[model samples]
Target: MRKTLEEKLVPPVPPAVRRAMLDAREALPPGGADVTARLFAAMKENRDAPTLPSSKSFRDAAASESTFRTLLRCLARYAPHICTSNAVTVSEEWYARRPKHVTMGKSTPVQPTIWPAAWRALAPALDAAPIKQSSKRRYRASIDRCAAMVRAGRASSDFGFVAAADLADAFLFNADATARVKPITAAGYLDGLIALGRFGGIDRVHLLPMQLVAEDLREQAAMMPKNKEARIGAFMERGGFGYAADRIAVCLRRAESLPVHSAAGRRALQTAMVCAVFMNKPARKGDMVSWRIGHDIVRQPNGEWSLAWQQGKTGKNTEAGVLWPEVCYILDLWILGGRPDRLVYHRYHELEGLFLLSQSECQAYRNLPSELTLSAIGVPSHDLRTAAADYMRHYDPEHAANVISAHLGHGSQKSGEAYRSECSAAAGQSEWQRSRMIWS
Candidate 1:
């Protein structure tokens, strides 16, 4: 076989080059490790070649555009190690250092007398539109993005207030402004345009761009099911969290056994305990952080601990009335000074939050740790909810869906059905294992 151009021209790299490559990778996101390794391997073999590819060529050749962006971010942090005077000119860091093209001005009610009637009418309609705060904020951001495009000479003047071909041209196809954005972000821009058109009373047919973008995204996303269980399992597997409940139990047990004598150790234990309860209750970040001590945590007449908190996502009042004894014990240790007396403080007493940091000085802060790492296994706090559903389905397949829906504060059975669908494959595996064990 003929040697390739790269193979013929480049000799094998040395230990120093490999060390530099590995050192550069520490700055990247977790997913970038493999890409960084491959890039470095090629660079190592060709010592005379540039340490990193030109930004455009690297981005164009990347299998995942997202990874390319991450590579750029990491390069910005460790550019000295990865690039030299002859390396990529159009790196993300260079662009970042340039003056920001986007700007926001104070918004005022559109003066009906000074503006076109269609554009002026939009102001009142937008104010009257019934939408959530988050949606409203997104709409405002979309308007701002459109305005920036116009100021940057990428779009026509009539972009946001009144819809036209120019708006879609700038938002969807204007390469100068949105060339780097992901399809999902483009879809969001389309949504913002549709909302603007709706409020402006533009013809429905004129909103074809937004519809087309949505259809395109839907077609792409259809390649994989949006089942929460599959997503949770994939997230865990990527982080070395085993696919079974027993594996997760072992990881949690190891986490819980960490010493609590020091402040940092106590904090780790606190995060672990919170994570265990989060999995047990299948709670969302909002639910975990919103808990108030006296209101959410109550001792029942039977002496068992219970939790009652409103789930903001579904707007439903929820209760995890039957807590496991282990969960209760962990909560007791956390609340009653898990750390040494000399290191403990009492300022947390004044805070209204249930999930405070374990450090005495930082206990007044109100956010729960959103992620936990147990040895090599990492679990996101939000995914714990899905893991809980999966666990229940494996152990109690018949009533798992309905039971988990109620436990997780879902408003409808359809929500539960999504979880059940995701858990089906895992549940089947569990069933087969049980049957095999019984026969053996």
Candidate 2:
């Protein structure tokens, strides 16, 4: 009974509840969001619902916590680490509603999801598509801007009025005049002139706006299976978001040309860069473009998302409901994202054009914290992870380790200890594309 309910819960029982369930768990609609509160109610009543919990679902979530903490998070609409006191009572009630697990006398396989039937029939010969390289700086700036705009009312424009004279009298805007003052230039003037509203505080203008070629949407679009559970790699294998061999090659060049000695050295340097970006934010492996949800890219209204994923490590169903929005969104955008189908697909490699790239003695970030120590210099990826934190704490100082940890997805503030050292963080996965200078 317990396992069956847990397995079937993927599609959700009642879709109304299901949609809300997903909203409560992952994607949240802007405003009118009582999900955190409702989610808490649900967790308090979870044992009464007749289902077994899954550990994988929550354990692997970015910044996942103990089962008790997870339930409290859903109840409180915030993470335990951030919460103050109100959450304690909600969590206590959650454990009180426990269900008996007699049905799990033996371990049965979790049932197959609807996506398998929907996609398994794909022909082995589907036409392969080309992928292009993405602009990490551009991608990062765009995401940061888009999220900020949504919080503000300016991103959406309304045009219901129809007045010919008023419209004709309006100023004519064109490239000639627009070129006189770049958006960046205008933003600088504005910051000096007016008060930017507070959503996340720094009222920086969203640069990745549509229309301008230079201020192009920091786009990285990838289309993959709609199923939430599917890994983004499945979709990226085919390529989307203009991510092509050319672009990847460029990024690789950038990574390789960095002053680092080897791949690990490059990775160290990349880590340092991420440390710089995520100074005040919580940082996680999945938070950077390197760990996007879809391994490749996805086209989102905001911009392009290259990685889509479901963490395989998190289990315990109760913990799955707590998602740290901006943090998860950042993680899902490129780093840890990719369609599972693409990962499993036979043609993914050929279409991805990643085959031309060689596998490192390191499995990219996957083999990070590799069992193979520095034959003599000897420091693990964990050390690198730590070094990143320590450096941020000492050298960067201004940014919050919590913010860095949130972005990095460390289990604890102890993870923030990485800020206390002299560490070099470098980008690893596609370094060759990062620092390269293209002749064309």
Candidate 3:
């Protein structure tokens, strides 16, 4: 009798190992099951023995390096006993031995363009300007981009003199052409020009034109509707803040019940804490990721949790007082129970204070909110601010603007209004009327 297709694909492993792999296939997500099967087949091809091959051998047999990584994660989750080699070590080795193809079929390397003389001259001034390190980097990048645009348009080698006209031309080129830039990006380049003008390097008279253009660009960008109303409606339809809070509580409970060493438990704890923090206080993603224990997050004398940080965008001192008890509880669980287990021993000294340890971990936390909710209320982490703003506006019309200004770390009350949904106005009016009747 001829062998079936499934039998032909099955690797010659022990019955027990084969059973574990079969269970893994059943347990894993659709994509993950495929990856697991590929991993098993690769292992069989690399060695004659029924025993698992070295990580390097498996990597060699993998279709791509990413596939090898997925296999490692699958092994860690479903068949940990069989995975003896350290995943991190194998990853480092794979990275080190990755094919170093200098040219992709006779392609020459593109060298970085040297900074134009005008930008180079202003570099020292930009560095010395009492601005944040991040801002300085952004301004420098904008200058480089603007210079490239100018060089591409003009034939002059002495593209050393940057002026208001040049910047306006660049903006127009980016706004109306094939290589168009976003309005926000154009605003950034204009900011770079304004900075240069303020440094006394360029003519101060040029400042007005750049500022006006930047303002118009910003207004236009803001006026372009993003279908936020539909998203907000969908979010509220799914029980809004109440539903999210309930889900977070469930995640916290699950985390607490699972063993301390469980990676799934750690992730659940992380997701709960992140959602709680964002729910109580909607902060910028950068601020959320960069939160250090003692500095940004602190325990007050009254035993209430407090957050204090300078807003990265507006550079304003922002503070949130006495967070929700649920938020505080989850923070405690993460700090006392979860974070320590997740930290690598050697790197503990360096990363112990950071709330979200690394960029990858931060990304995972950001992604968890949507995944946990089954994509019913999908929104980026930043959109949490809008949600909070809309919720506040609905409940309290008079105080919402002021509260939103402080809650979201906005520079002014006017800035807070940008986050308010159109529907919130009607909701706020009805709530205000109900409040009047109750008080009357």
- In order, candidate lDDTs are 0.54, 0.30, 0.62
TM-score of 3: 0.59
Ranking by TM-score: 3, 1, 2
Better of 1 and 3 by TM-score: 3
Each model's backbone clash number: 0, 112, 0
Instruction: Estimate, for each residue in 229-337, the C-alpha lDDT of model 2 and write its tens digit.
Output: 2322332343411232233334335544432212343443333333222322322332222332224223233332223333222211111122334323432221211
Across 1-440, the per-residue lDDT of candidate 1 in tens digits comes to 86432342232433444345455544446655444444555454444345434334453434564665565554444443443212222333344555554457544454322333444457667767887655666776666665566556665544332333455456556666635444455556657656867877877666665567556654655564555456566765664223333444554455345422223444555665575566557677655665666567654434356788877667788888868876665555555433322221232243334444432222332234465423323555666666666667767775677777887789777767677775666667767988999999
* Residue 365, model 1, lDDT: 29
Worst 10 residues of 3 by lDDT: 357-366
Model 1 RMSD in angstroms:
18.4
Better of 1 and 2 by TM-score: 1
Candidate 1: 10-residue stretch with minimal lDDT: 339-348
* lDDT score of residue 224 within candidate 3: 70
**lDDT accuracy of residue 366 in candidate 3:** 33
On TM-score, the stronger of 2 and 3 is: 3
Best by lDDT: 3
**Candidate 2, TM-score vs. the true structure?**
0.19
TM-score of each: 0.50, 0.19, 0.59
Per-residue lDDT tens digits for candidate 3, residues 254-287, read 8766644355666677777777788888787766
